[model samples]
Target: MNAVAHNAQSVINAAGSTLEFLSFTLGKEEYGISIQKVQELRGYDTVTRIANAPEFIKGVVNLRGIIVPIIDMRIKFKLGTPSYDQFTVVVILHLENHVVGMVVDSVSDVITLTPEQIKPPPEMNSALATDYLLGLGTVDERMLILIDIEKLMSGADMGLAERSPA
Candidate 1:
């Protein structure tokens, strides 16, 4: 086989066996979510505060015509003081017929990981509960905490649903 054709075949084979993740950072740690769950990426914008909302619930913003509740993973995980800088981004996710946005320090890139690169998360007490993690993915020298975005968003603590007026 020609060198060029061999390389093309290798690329095609790799793409079919790997899963893609949209990697982002929160504090110094790196995290990733399934790329299929991501609806879009948006710059961090001011959100309207909701009464009686939890601190992690940064509030809601109008995304096109729909309202999206923005959650700060840093606050949700009690990592540290969450800040909004130029690098701050909101990852819009479409889950279970609901749209939500998550704020992260910065979005790095989309990474493809084969099943062999993923490891089951270790059982330990940590800021983030294990239930919210899919597993750990290692790429090169970096480790990505694979977030179960759907479970995290729909959990009771997130309060993603709109509260009806009393």
Candidate 2:
């Protein structure tokens, strides 16, 4: 192949091998989710509480006429008592069949991590189970806990819808 063709192929291969993540902060630690699953990001807002719902479930919100259940990650992960302020954000996720919102402290940025930059998460007793973790992604001096968002949101514990909205 010619030099120019080789360079173009290299670029295409590199892009195909890398994955993009939407990074956000929970407390002092950072976490990431696949960017493809993110529907939108919205500032924290009041949600109508559901009767007899779990505390981790902040309740549901009307998003453009669709009611979306909001789950607070800080509470779910047992990081600490969650405090809401201007910086708090709700990341709307579009899963295979359902749409849900996850509240976080704040969103950092969208980071692209090559396959080589990701490492398997350590197997240790922690608030979050290893099954819910995709791996740990390292970018520069930062280490982000890559979350398996689909698995987490779709689990029976989350009580999310199993079918897409009509």
The TM-score leader among the candidates is: 2
TM-scores for candidates 1 onward, in order: 0.84, 0.86
The global C-alpha lDDT for each of the candidates, from Candidate 1 onward, is 0.81, 0.84
Root mean square deviation (Cα) for candidate 2: 8.0
- How much is 8 displaced in model 1, in angstroms? 31
Please count the clashing residue pairs in each candidate, in the order shown.
Answer: 0, 0
Candidate 1: C-alpha lDDT: 0.81
lDDT of 1 at 39: 90
lDDT of 1 by residue, 1-166 (tens): 4333343334335557888999999989999998989999999999999998899988999878887888998999889998898999999988875888899999999999887787766666556356666678899999998876876777777786443321
What would the TM-score be for candidate 1 when compared with the true structure? 0.84
Candidate No. with top lDDT: 2
| Per-residue lDDT value at 23 in model 1 | 98
Over 4 Å off, model 1:
1-16, 125-128, 161-166
> In candidate 2, where is summed lDDT lowest over 10 consecutive residues?
3-12
